[model samples]
Structures are given as C-alpha cells and as structure tokens.
Target: MIIEIKVPSPGESITEVEIGSWLVEDGAVVAKDQEIAEVESDKATLTIVASEGGKIEIKAEEGEAVEVGAVVCTIDTSVEAPAAPAEPKEKEEAPEEEKEKPEAKAAEEKKSVPESSEHDKVKVTSVAKEMMKEHDLSLDDVINGLKRLGKKEVEAVVNAPQATAAAIPQKEATRDEERQRMSSLRRKLSARLISVKNETAMLTTFNEIDMSYVMDMRKKYQQKFVDIHGFKVGFMSFFTKAVATAMDFHPMVNAQIDGEEIVMPQFVDVGIAVSTPKGLMVPIVRNAESKSIPAIELEIKELAEKARNKKITVEELQGGTFTITNGGVFGSLLSTPILNPPQSGILGMHNIVERPVAVNGQVVIRPMMYVALSYDHRIIDGKDSVGFLVKLKELLENPERLFTGGKDAGELMLGI
Candidate 1:
C-alpha cells in the first residue's frame, strides 16, 4: 500500500504554495509524522510530514509550485523495513596486516603532495600580462616571485623602484553566480506593496519625540519591570500605548475606508509588524487599548516569536485597526511606512540618536527619535493625522500619563 502525501492548506485564500526543500531523500525510509518537505505559502512556511512509516517516493521537486491538497509525495507502506546488517566474520591476521600496509602507504603519499598545487591555475588579467611585457618580466618570474599575480600585483611590481620576479598564481578566486526563483512570500509582499500604493491615497506626517524621559525611565526600571512582568519594558509598548491612547482623541486615523463607507471599530486591534525570514508578518495585539503596558509587552514578544518561528496562525495575522513597525531594530534612522490595507494608519519607529535641541530657552542635548505616521488621506484628514502624531509624541516623551487616564499621572510609572 502507498500512502500519498498531499499539501495542506496553510491559510485562507492561499491555494498555492512553493515547495521549499526536502528533508528526506527519495527511497529513504521515513517514520510516521516525520517532516519531509518545507512548503512556503505567501504568508508562511509550513512543513510536509510523512503520514506513515515507509520508503518515500518524491512526486514534487524543490522550488516547484504546489497547490493545496495536491499530491507531493507517496509512502510505500507495503515495503518491509530494512534488515540489520550481519556481523562480519573475524578477519585473518595476515589479511588485516596486508590491508593496513596499503592504507598507510596511500595516506603517506597523500600527505607528501601539497593541497595548494591542485588549484595552482589562476586567470591572468590582460592588464597584468601587458605590464609584465612592459617591465620585460616573464609569467614564471612573476608567478614564482609573488605566488599571486593580478592586475594590482602586476601594477605593484611594475611601479616598484626595482623590478621583481612575477609570482605564479596559486588558486584563482573563481567568480560564481546563481539565480533562484523568488519565494511565494516575497512575491506576495511585492504585489501587496504595489496594491497599497496604487489603491490608497497615502500621506506621511513626521514628528520627533524627546527620548530623554523614556531613556531615563528604562535605565531605572527596566530590570524591575522585567522582574515583575517576566519581559523587558521596551520602546514598542510605549509607542503602542501612545497610539492606542491617541486614537481615542483622533478616531479618523484608526478608521479604514470600506468602499463608500468608513468603518470604525470600537476596539483598537493594533498590528505589530514583525520581520520574519519568510517576509514581513503583521500579528495583531488584539484589543491593545484595554491591555496594560506589561500585558502589551508580553503579547508582543509572544506574537513576534511566533511570527519569526513560522508558528503564528492565520487568525493572529488578520484584522487590525492600525499597525506599528519599528525599523529602528534594523538601525533605520527614519522611514515612511506604508499603510496596511483596510487600516488607515501605520506608525513607523526609527533609531534614537542624541542631538542638541531647544528646551525652554536654552539648547540642550537630548536623545530623540523621529517617528512617522503614514495614513490614508481618504479617511484621515491632515489635521487629524498631524494631531494624532503630536499626541503620540507627547505621550511617548512623557510616558507616565500612558498608564493613567491623563490626570496628574504620577511619575512613579516611570520610576521617578
């Protein structure tokens, strides 16, 4: 009996997937539930596992596009397991001695020859040959002198005050090139990016936040906060909380344009854009408005881990009121992030740098971060977008108010 293995559906609307790699070789025996191939969908990478123990017969090749429920391989369950090898009979001492002598002699001969000699041939550049001729130098002279001769080497020898013998090339650095088909995830990302640009009336508004307070707070309470919450209180939670809070005053930035109607949700499902090997995955931090700072940090960490590990589910990836992407992690100074579809806004976070700025009437050095909010102009007015960013800046700059409802929000939230 042969058990046919078919591709499993990775997510909704993802009917096709590219076969990534095969973990087992054809005709190799595999156990039940053993991972055999990696399948890449537009959104995620999934594993194809053997259904039962048997020899595998590959029906699909790597880098090939396979559809959901399509047969990828088969397991020959009827084939018997390979029998264990029989023990060898004791060898005669005379035969063993004879084998040892030949093996030792071969190894000694191998050691006598230098491995470098095997790859001594090198491509001689035209410039180098011309220089050699000009300098009246032989190829062997150049080769024997330097043991390496290129255009640079030839020039160096020629330019030197005294003429030197050319060194023979020993192993040329071969220039190799390769081309591979793009994965489904990369292709999907490109198409989605293009669609977003073409479909939405996108506009970006920029503002800088003073990180002096946030930095001081983190320095003082990062350890305590991590001890209390089992996760460090990073800049993301502050920005996420700020965005959620700012949405309360400027709802238009959070509302998405649905045909002629603008749809607004009562809750804030903030999408935290996570960069994974497959591509960029936005996992929602569901009801971000209602969660505490500690809770938000924990959820973000888990969601990000899941996204990176390809363990995140489709439900987690779908539906968000807005998105926040921190290009700062990759040392980006500033970038105008694109709006995720249906969501009116995406907040871009950049690296923090210490710079001189005016505080009150005097110039003072402060740690600052440039933040950009890209929103759909169709639903979000310029005033609302700018106001939302201003509010976010204020919230992040003075983050104590983030936990409180904005009263004389105590500085204790910042460990002050």
Candidate 2:
C-alpha cells in the first residue's frame, strides 16, 4: 500500500510554507513516526513525520513553497526498512608465539643501532612513531635519510632573500558574493517590523535602577533557591515579577486599543523575548502576576529551550499582553525596543555598569542598569508610561517590595 504524506498546517491564516530542509534522503526507508522533513511557516518551523515504516519517495524538493495539505512525499508500506546490524563479539586471543615474534624483531632492531643520549632526548609524536613502525624504519634510518648541506646549498640559503620571503604564508584577497532566498518566517518578520514602525505612535521612556539590592539578594539566597527548586533563578524572573507587580498601579500600560474600544486585561501575561536561530520568538508566561519567582524561572527555561529547538507551537507564541526583552544578554548598554503590535507596551533591559552617583548627598559608585519602556501613545499617555517605569524601578530597587504589593515593608505594616 502506498500512503501519501501531506504538509500539515502550522496555524490559522497561513496558506503556504517553504520546505526548510529534508532530514532524510529521497527514497530512504523511514520508520513510523520518524521526522523526515522540516517546514518553515511564517509563524514557526514544523516537522513532517512518517505515518508508517516504509521507503519514502520525496515529491517536493527542499526550499520549494508548497500549499498546506499538499502531498510532499509518499511511502511504500510494503517495503520495510533494513534492520540495524548487530554488534560483533570479541575475537579469541592470538597464540603466544605470534606476539613474541614481533617483540623479538623490535629488540633486534633496537640492539642494531643504539641512539645517542642527545638523539634519545628528541621527542617522537605517537603519530610519527606509528608511521615509522608501519614503514619498518627506525629513528636512525630517518636521521640518515637527510641530505648533507654543501657549499652550494649554504650559498643559496645566504643569497636568496626573495625566495625566503616568498615561502612565508600570505593571505589572498577575493571578492566573492552569495545570495539566498528568504524563508517565509524571515519575510513575514520583515513585513511586521515595517508595519509596527509605520502604524503606531510609539514613545520610549528611560530610567536607571540601582541593582545593589537585587544582586545582594541573589548572592544570598541563590543557593537556597536552587536547592529547593533544582534550578537557579535569573534577573529576567525578577524583572518579570517586578513588571507584573507594577501593573497593579499602572494598569493602563497593559491596555490595548481594539478598534474604537480600549481592551484592558485583568491578568498579566508577560512575554519573554528569546532569540533563536530562525528569528526572535516571544513565548508568553501566563498569569505571571500570580506565580512565584521559582515557578517563573522554570517555565521560562522550558519555553526558551523549546523555541530554540524548533519544537514550539503557535499557541505558545500568542496572547501576550506585554513583553520584556533583555538586551543585556548581548551586552547592549541601551536601546529603545520597538513595540509588539496590538500590545501597547514593551520593556527593554540593558547591561549593568558601575558609575558614580550621588547617594544621600555623598558621591558613591553603585551597579546601575538603564531600563526603557516603549509604549503606543494612541492608548498610553506620557504620565502612565513614566509612572509605569517609576513603579518598576521601585519594585526592582527594593525587591522585597515585590512581595508586599509594590509598597515599602514599613508602610504595609503601618497601614499607611
């Protein structure tokens, strides 16, 4: 029986996809449920697997754009895949005489020509020694093979400056160019970036935070956290927690304009921007406001691993109310991040640097990081944007405030 393998739809509204690559060669035997090819759609890269064990005949070539549900290959189920070869067993030991013959021959050769102390000091690499042994040549035989230098040879070495210069390696320059067709994912990304810049009234607000408190907290409790959770926590989790807590005071930052109506979500779903080989992918952490730091860290790690391995689904990449991108991983000191459309706000984190700043009327150096919030002005005003960042700064600078609903411990205890 012959079974046709068709391309699977990656997501809704996507009609076509480019064949990213063929994992197996054409006409090769494939086992049931084995992945044979990868298809690149505008949203994500998906794999095509075999339904039954059989020989596969590829119909669509790689890099060709095929419509969804089109047949990309067919399987001949009658022809089974060849079984893997069995491992060989160890051989019986050789006769003692056979081994002694080689040892005796080596001893005879060593006695024939005893090397000088100076010659014994010369190191022979394992590879060179193996080659000499294979050729039945000893160290003396190799030394004697060298030709003696004569007067003519000495004169040639002294007089030939140009020849010596030519012997040195030099880099040759070439003007070579190569072009490749853009995949569906890259083309879609290009279109979306251009649309974001043209459609929204985006504005960015910047602020600096003293990271001494967060760093000290991590240093103090990191081991305890890891021992209990089995994974280390990172700054992204702290920033994500801070962003979620600050949303309570500045809910407008999480609101988006839906046509004539402004849709404000009651819950916070923070998207963490992860850079992968295919492109930038944002995987949403659902209900971040209700989760603890350890829980958030583990989820982010799992989602990022899936995204980079091309195993992420379209549903995992959608329905994010706000996004947080850390350019600090790439050593970005500061950058105004572009807004992810439909969502009104995105935060950018930068690398930390030690600089002098006034603290209680005294000059001191502290670890500081610059944070930027880029929001759509159509739905978010300057007052909300600036206040959102201030709230985020307060939460981060006093990380304990995150546990107390973005308020000081004293204020919370005093009922102020």
Candidate 3:
C-alpha cells in the first residue's frame, strides 16, 4: 500500500509553504513519525514527519513551493516476496578520466578567463560571467574550474580580474537563473515593513544605557539561576523587566496611534526581536511583569528556538505592545533599530566595552553598553520618549530597582 503524504498546515494565516529541505533520500526507509523534510512557512519552519513507517518516494523537491494539504510524497508499505538468489553485485571501478577531474577543475580555476556556455549556457552570476565573457572563456571551462576549486576560487578569478580590456559585447544582463522560492515569512516581513514605512510617521530617537549594573548582576547570578532553573539567567530578563517598569510609568511610550484615536494597552506584552533565516521576528512575551526572571529567560529562549526552527505561530508574532532588539549579540557597537509596526517603540541593545568614565570626579574603567529606543514621533513626544528611555536606563543601571519597580514602587513587583 502506498500512503500519500501532503504538506501539513503549519500555523494560522499560512496557506502555503516553501519546501526547504529533505532529510531522507528517495527510496529510503523512514520510521513512523520520523522527520523527513523541513518546510518554510510564514509563521516558522516546520519539520514534515512520516505518518507511517515505510520506504518513501518523493514528488516534491527542495526549494519548491507547495500548498497546505498538497500531496508531496508517497510511502510504500508492501510485503516483500521471496525471489531466487541474486548474483553478487561487483563494486564499480573508478574511471581514470574521472580521477583527473579534480586536477582539471583546479587548472580551470587558476585560469584568468571566465567561461560562457555555447551549449545552453549556465548564466553564471553577473560579475563572474562578465569577466569571463570579456576574456572569451568557455562556460565548460568556468564550470570545470568551479567543480575543481569550489566557488570561492572562482570568485577570486571574477573579482580580482576587473582589468579585462572591456571588449566583451554588452549583453542585456537582466536574466537570473538563481530561482530561490521566497518563504511565506519573508513575504509577510516585506509587507509589514512596507506598511510601517507608509502608514506611520516613524521617527527614531537614540540613547545609550550603561550595562555595568546589568552585566555585574548577570555575572553574579547567571550560574546559580541556570543551576536552579535549568537555564542561564540573561540580560534579556533584566531588559524586559526594565521595559515593563518604564511602560507602567510612561504609559504614553507604550501607546500607539489608532488613526482618529490613541490606543493604550494596559497590559505589557513585550516583543523580543529574534533574527532567523526568515529574517527578524519579534515574538512577544505576554504580560511579562507576571513572569519571574527564570521564567522570562526560559520563555525567550524557547520562543527564539521556535522562531529559528520555524515553529513560531502567527499569534506569537502578533499583538506586540513594544519591542526589544539586542544588537549586542552580533557585536554591534551601536545601532538605531527600526520600529516593529503598530508598536510605538523598539529598544536596541549593543555590545559592551569598558570605557573611561568620570565617577565622583575620578577616571575609572567601567563596563558599559549603549542602548537606543526608536519611537514613532507622531505619537511619542520627544519628552516622553527620552524620559521613558531615561527611566529604562535608571532601572537597568540599578536592576534591583527593576525587581522593586524603580526607586519608589518598592519590591511590590516581585510579590515579596
């Protein structure tokens, strides 16, 4: 019996998905519930699992776009019949011609000329092909070179040899052969970013926060927190707590414009900006104020993993009251982060380095991180935005106050 397999619905609002990769080869026996392929959806990447144990035949290939419930493969589960003893299969001998293929490829890569296809030319990337065309090199030669030394060697040939006498005929160079299917998530990202650009009077305001206190606190408690909760306590927890405190204090910063009316959210659903192969996704941690530092850390880590694996849901991506993006992980010294739509503000965290500072009129080396809060200028006034960031900085610099809800709110936030 052949069991037909179809693409499963990944999440809400995702009607289609791009087949990203196949984990098992055709005719390979896969166990029931074994992950066989990965699909990229608007919400996240989902693993296509085997429904029944069997040898499979694939109808879909990698990088192909398929719709939900579309038949993608067939699983055969037929009983094997007895047959006569088969002859011993001899191992194939390596052809001498094939053995020299590597040396040929290497020689081709070393060639200063590029290749053009006379037989249905593989339109190489523009720059590489152009350089080759000018030198009147054959596509077979270039491909052979690529096969020998790989693309990096070929790239060096294309990039370094810009000095070819400009004699190549001008070919209308608009055709592209690299047909990568865009994931649903990427399309959504484009649409949302365009909406933000067109619909909102977005303006970015910048400020730097000193992470010395936050860093020290993490160093002080990270190991113990990890040991107790089975996950390391991270700066994100402190930042989220600080953002929640600041939002509670300056409700305006948490507010967004609803055309004729201003919409203010009483609950703090802080969106964490996580970068994935699909791009930047901000998965919100709803009502972050209620979660402890350990809980917050776990939730953020889980959400980020989901985002990477393409297991995130549309609901998880929606309803972000505010966003926090940390560029520090990528070694960004400082950056002005863009606003994620509907939300008025986004926080940008940067890499920390010890800088000279005057503390009590004395110079000392203190570890510091620069922070930025970009806001929609139309709704968030300069004073409120700046003041809100100041509040964030103050809480972060003294994280104990974040647990205590700033200097005046005491430790009521922690329910202690």
Could you tell me how far off, in angstroms, the CA of residue 277 lies in candidate 2 after the best superposition?
Answer: 1.0
Best of the candidates, lDDT: 2
Models sorted by lDDT, best on top: 2, 1, 3
Model 3, which residues run further than 4 Å from truth?
A: 61-63, 79-181, 409-416
Residue-wise C-alpha lDDT for candidate 3, range 1-416, written one tens digit per residue: 98999998766667888888899999888878888998887656678898888889999988888989999999987733235489999989888776667777766664544443354534467787667656756667656655356788678777763545577667786866787666666887788889888877776666666677777878987788878888787888888888888887789888888877999988899999999876778889999877777788889999999888767776787787899998999999988888887889988888888999888999988888888888888888888888988898888777778666677454464655
> Candidate 1 lDDT, tens digit per residue, 215-293?
8999999899878777788888888888888888898888987789989888899999998877889999988889988
TM-score attained by model 1: 0.73
| C-alpha lDDT of candidate 1 relative to the true structure | 0.84
* lDDT, candidate 2, 100-124, per-residue tens: 6778877766644344354885456
lDDT, residue 42, model 3:
60
Please, what is the whole-model Cα lDDT of each candidate in the order they appear?
0.84, 0.91, 0.80
Higher-ranked by TM-score: 2 or 3: 2
* Cα-based TM-score, every candidate: 0.73, 0.79, 0.71
| Residue 307 in candidate 1, Cα distance off native in Å | 1.7
* Candidate 2 deviant stretches above 4 angstroms: 84-171
